[model samples]
Target chain A: MPLPAPSPNPNPAPPDAGMSRRSFLRTSAVLTTGLAALAASLKPLLEMNDFPTMERFLQKYYKEMTPEDMEKVLKRIEAEVEKQYGIRPHVRDLKPMDGVEFVYCLNLTRCIGCRKCVHACVAENNQSRNPEIQYIRVLRLPHGSLDIEKAEHNYAPESVPEKGYFYMPVQCQQCKNPPCVKVCPIHATWQETDGITVIDYDWCIGCRYCEAACPYWARRFNFTKPSIPKERLNPDMAYLGNRPRRQGVMEKCHFCIQRTRVGRYPACLEVCPTGARKFGNILDPNSEVSYILKNKRVFIQLKEELGTSPRFFYYFDV
Target chain B: MLRLVLCTQPRSSLVAFGGSARMRPVEGDALTRAGDPMNSQTRTTLVLTGLILAFLALTTLFISNLPGRPLRQPPIPLVNTNFLDTATVRRSYADLVRAGEDLSDFDCYACHEKGKPPPLRYDTNQNLIVPKEHSDIVMGHGSHGRNNNCFNCHNETNLELLQTRDGHEVKFADSPSLCGSCHGPTYRDWEAGAHGRISGFWDRSLGAAERKACVNCHNPHSPHFPSRPPAPGPHPLRPVATASVEPGPNH
Candidate 1:
């Protein structure tokens, strides 16, 4: 007997023809539920890895910020200093002095290698802790001997040059014609109108040409990044004088230009216990240096032959 | 169409019989061949097997011998390594101008040339440049048999015609500190006020810590100490003889 014609159903059952429809529906429901639960659990995992928030917390350079941006930076700097150093700092904005001339005069006969001037200078200038970066050097020489050879400057504690040696402190002479200014490759160093030579730390490329050009041995190059642990740092930093310096750049005694130009004496002059240093305007005929030059009979200048025309002058008791 | 060719092939009978399956197919024998289902199926299987084996062999050879093929290396990028070049020296000159420093006409190279100035000639005499006499005491040069030279104090950059910040040019090194290297004793004395000559009268108000450099006292080129003049004859004599006899009468 011929089988009854099969129903010509255009849409036949799915490939699981042997399984009941309920079984197929149950399998699909379990898969859908599992996928939904997995998606819900992954949402919090993705939120935990927020990268943008981390990038906003880092500090940046001063030139890269605007006035509005700097307020936030200043606040951050204040917070960091408090957290790291346990001290509050007073930050200020300072500018170079205009229309003033600063000159330094050294009395070689009187300097007594006490190194108080050196220490005072370091403190005033906010210098690095390394002893090698000292701005002032007190040399001891033999008495009654004009010969530089007989001079013994390497004195130990009780360093007063033996019975015959005299002391002299050498520093930046604030030359009217500074060779260092001429040699700087980047205009990062310049003599201010006030006669104090200054440097722009940010602008300096650390080529050390200025150090090579200075005649007074007044300039020093920072070989490594300065370390002034935030607590020891003097926050009343001068723009051209004593803000913590960078590595590989040249620096010199600015005659305490920041303080002096503000109508105050340099730290060395203020703290000198022996009154060996004299600071005044050479241009003013009535200034103390001018009076000293006029009244002193035993006055002399170092390397007068080199013609550097240094403002520093010396005198001794006859 | 492919089935018809396989069925017509003489290899179809060889495939069905196993050992004789290597025979080549001949054209124009479709109907009788198709009647034998087993032979057609065997022929089709053999052809498919041969194609797959050829493809795999090619893939294996290509992967194994890849290391023997030549490689192309990328080119190096350019950089500004000319830090000490003439252009840099010239830029230094520009920097001086911006800083407002004056440039003297004295170019360091003019006097410091290798063959022209004569090696080891610091002064006009052409004698080996000697350290200042005091450098011995200050720098311990006496211990070294005076081995140090002007180059020791005045470091040489070995570059010619270095540029200044003002577009003018000068030497690469400065004078005072260069001189200080060998003249350490003198330099220290100058700093401490012991070595160099002092100018001006002493005052109680001005401190002794402010001393001048050695260059301020004796010249580096002709460092001669001025001889002290003899004391005047009318100076006070200590322990003078008293008129003892006349004093006794007055008492």
Candidate 2:
């Protein structure tokens, strides 16, 4: 009887195996709810206004781009900057000049900690105003001490060169063996031929490895979309220099690459009331930097024990 | 897989409920135990559905609380931070010369009689009393009033010319060399392009470098740099009001 009942069905459905209408409804409800939850979780990404366009997403790495590619990129950047800030910027990709290596010499004896350089840099470079980004941090330290840990970073007194204190303005050292460049997961930042450690803002993933790796605390991250006043926008821009940065890219002092490459003094150097900041071509023997290195009492590089070999030299006139 | 897990969860929990149901005289067991109006599987499904709904609600609440775009505020005003003291006597002289300004404005003899230099007057304290005509000048040139006399730099024989310590006549434009007469080291540093501000090109082939004169930064009457309020410091994302400098043992 069992043999007769077993028909030649290779795939047999048991009595209770078929899907009921209730079960089907249950499964569909679960599926719909799960899909709704997934959609809800992605709301933030959908609301983002700064999501990259197809062109920006597909743009080549900075070093890999040809001159024609750079030209197009610069033009695109100009258009983007204009659209965002309501001013058409004169953006150019200035190359490091031949027979030039920039070196900065800061006379510690003369720095009054007026912080004019910091503001000048902010005006020159289009740093964010709200949640402000300043390149130079003037540390007010007690006299007869060289320890940076004991330095006051946020000291806002009535006047600078306060009694029993000295000022040291610290920015990017432009290290020859840069730890920031080495630690970047993507090679978004690297040292140029002219000793400027430049970052390709477009290629950066905002991981902030370079920022963390920097010994000088020079690197800054744009956590939000930079809010710059349209009227205050600096039109003279360089691709890897003072060009307005996007949210989540790293930026630091490039020795005012745009000005330095075009044979103009940096805004910071020009704005120093005490004439403390000195910058020149280290390659030229007759340059001011070379003279200071030879004649002035130049001390060890900032955090030289880390072997960063910073191009910035601190000197004493005594 | 979710259904399988959901169905399995209530069996153990239902067993615990069953014990309590049985303890109830008869109505509790009839309502919730094995043979009831609503079966255990249906009851478990309802419980899980309610749970999923609650979880989704909480998740939605959490997502809404996440940080969004910052509220647009009025733009922060830009400040004039170029604090270089470029409005001194030399700056005015340089500006006049560059503009090809009338020489009579600067010519001392235009006010004073020909071949007559103004007599130097001193207060009872022996401090040089600046005349009413040159009341704008505040003389504090050298330490301890050593170089306060007008005849030190200004020539008495000729009102227009200035004489260096070596008796060399120096024009106002070449006053850096005149300052070199006393401040030899500073002048040397300035000549070598180390001292003072040097604008324009560092590479000589590209452009001419403009070295600022001594009086461009320093006031001839008072050479000491006057202290002023510093520019505002960094505005960090997080407001940290704590003092950064802790008096450590090393300091």
Candidate 3:
């Protein structure tokens, strides 16, 4: 090159000595290095998907949320679910009924292995359309045997009542010493003053601890998102009973706490054709249940060995 | 002289500048010699001082937060016997009478096992029909053995029977309390959410809805009573079979 440019002075003056090219290069280099380091450090944090935090921000627990907050949260949840599942879910608040109580009686003698209650419960509770997740199970057992291995529920319609077969509908026994309540780690489930056990859906961590402790096999977990369409959803919902549930929480029969406590009968009880299901206040003397107990004999319950002390009872004419 | 040049830079450099060089030795030489020991001693002292200060601070914090005195146990409320008094029991009996109910047939032992007639007479009135010896008849009821009796459930209510407006005799109270008499364990369980009906609802604000009673699910008299079947489902009609053993042989 034309007489190599005079060797530039190595030491550059400060910025105060008029803007210089050397100073420009030094400042730009420092700035570039700092930006690179910052971008590298922040990459991992920015990439992380905080759906749970987003969900919390979008919707708060019913207890923590005000009425206005709940309305906004409900709409947000409905929208979020629609985006995820391609279906909008209807969410409502289910409050406990006043004064009324619900009880269930199963006639082991008359049941003919008909699973009407199971289907009825699914429809009533708005459960997902999965065969394994039924609330009620009508067990087909031998007439004189109590062994669970001897029981079978896999019968075709024509195979029902084949010779000496009897039907036993096993549901949540609602034990006086409910083992499920004792095993919950987070206190997500508890007994109400009205003698019903309930679960807090949000507090549940999906650990499935209560599911193992229940003797009645009455509890069911939501493996996948529930699929009730927004338009078809039942607007009336209860905190402990038939509100739509999320994926991975333990739920069971509350004896229709929402219905019975409000002077209404449970769906299963209402549908039983033989009038086999009876519910009332054990406190009331004139109720029909009291009269029957006075008149009838030969009543029994399942698994008295575990000392669960279930509220449900069964009797036969003998 | 040749040796002297090498020696001059070495040995002579020290001696040539005697006092000034000696002063340098006093300054630089002594500092170099004592540097490691002084540094080590200072480090050890600093570490020990810090540890002691930290421990003292922690102990002071703990002691300052401790309670001044031991906690005292709470006082227990005195038990009242007014409800159990004989006079109160008489007044309750009078109230039952005013309700048009008879007082003679309402004793605890009357319908219970020890009574001449069990409190709830379904068929025949036999003394001690369900004998106290046969107390272990049901699940939760039998757990307390014979030590528990009707008063456990009847509580302070007078056992005197009363006649209803319809000219029917009945207990002063209702079933749950009446049954709760001897079955104290189950009664407590029921009161605290153990042995009773539990119903769920979908809608809560529609006023009143039809609900089942405890007796509807349980039979208090029998204890472990089974629920009856729903009204029977519709059955398929069957063809009539006619008797037709031809009279051909007779003709």
Candidate 4:
């Protein structure tokens, strides 16, 4: 039998050889539409390069990054901060030195209810100025009561230490078993070796689980974009610390990481009018925190039942 | 068409299967492995050489395009305005002692040592000694129903030195000790980092630690902790309605 010339089909499409042109056109049209849809969806993912959204999306957990990657990220952030705010930004990735565990103890007996610590903390930590994110809240408590719920945070008195009231400034307790760290959906926040619970602001998705989990009401949510005057912004900022934070992130006092890690008192302790605020390495035997802890009647804030084991202490001296 | 060779074929038979520049239809086994001119080793060598050349080129491009060496930034000068009022940070005793004003700038020997063998028997009750020169001295210290006089706290023998309750002479630099004699508990609290103002470095190893003297904060005349207007309080977007405590200007 004389065989017909082999069909032009490369494989088993021999049955549809007559309608090849129409079938090919239909297949091409479907592929083109599918690719177009994919490109449209991908456009959002690509166009966010201007806002660091792409970088944030691709960012691995902090510990996963290689040193070179970390260096590139830090440099990129430094350029961003410098460009956004008209000041040089020093974004440092500092390690907690060996044998240094930070602690802060405030003397309720000596706190004069002056909000100098609060203001100093805001300015030093690069907190938002207009909507006013303050890490320290000096609560005026009626004498003979330790009820924090009854303690007034916005109490503005004519004079401080109002005859029957004592002032207690509350900030992040920096718990050893931090509930804030525990509740984060992503590992954006973690407790440092030195007992500071630091948040990776860029890594944070602003889910606010950490904010809601805190017992002391320590964390502050950045609602709108933070507004800090360029002149007042502290250019010296740590990577996980007072580095000007973005909106939708959660922030609290990291015990002044930029200053404290380099062996300086926190801004609150530095500017405390009454010397009630004391911060130091608890591991160092001769630290002022050790002296205060040993000699005063010290106590912790809420979490008695929660058992967060906060490093921040409240002490009263007779 | 995919099987066609270009430029030139090898030399041999006209078919070129044996090496000659000619095209000829042949069976599947016509092109044997050995008919190829280049060996496996040569192919690998060429591939590796090309790969190495490509890698070197990429490395050179990357190295040349790297950011230039970092130049050290000369520190931008900052104004040293303090975070708060002078109440938060006063000139330390070390600062005052450096200026040689530890003696409270009182020229004491002019009146008390008027004789060859000055009997420094200045009576505490003699308040009218130098009314013109000492008028600014507020005697309001003893306003709490006690008729205390100058020599009560000032050493009569040496007017420059503070007198302690145990009749011990305390240099003005050692005023905390002198005050500790009377306000024992507060002095102990101050010593324990609880009472007084400690400015400057928390780690004493860093720099000269500044601890304010008892007299630095409290006026020795009044000796009461004077209350001042606190800094402006929290300015939340929604202003908090303060509870009905006696309203004052600090709010």
The top-ranked prediction according to TM-score is 2
Alpha-carbon shift of residue B113 in model 4 (angstroms): 6.0
Query: Alpha-carbon error at A172 in model 3, in Å?
Result: 1.2
Tens digit of per-residue lDDT, candidate 3, span A1-318: 578777653333333454334334333443544565566556545545433555654555456678887677667656655665566556554454454333455655445454556655655676654213567776666556666666555544343444566677888877877899999898888876556788877668788888999888888887555655454344445556676677777788877655665556676665553334555555445443454454444276678789987777765533
* Candidate 4 lDDT over residue span A34-144, tens digit each: 565565555545534346557766877788888888888788778878988878888887778788899888888778888888888888898987677889888887777
Cand. 2 TM to true fold: 0.83
* Candidate 1 residue-wise lDDT, A237-304, digit = tens: 55567766656667778877556655666767654434457776666665556655665543556565
Q: Score the docking of each candidate (DockQ).
A: 0.01, 0.32, 0.02, 0.16
Query: What ordering of candidates by TM-score runs from best to worst?
Result: 2, 4, 3, 1
* Interface RMSD for candidates 1 onward, in order: 30.6, 4.5, 27.2, 13.7
Candidate that would win on DockQ:
2
Per-model TM values vs. the true structure? 0.42, 0.83, 0.45, 0.70
Cα lDDT of model 2 by residue, B145-175, tens digit: 8677887887777867778876888787777
- Winner on DockQ between 3 and 4 is 4
Query: What does candidate 1 score on TM?
Result: 0.42
1 versus 2: better TM-score goes to? 2
Overall lDDT per candidate, in order of appearance: 0.51, 0.79, 0.52, 0.70
Candidate 4 off by > 4 Å: A1-50, A53-57, B1-94, B99-105, B109-147, B205-208, B245-251
lDDT for each residue of candidate 1 in B139-179, tens digit (9 for 90 to 100): 22333335335434333444444333233433433333444
lDDT of 2 by residue, A44-109 (tens): 687688978888899999999999999899989999998898899999898998888999999998
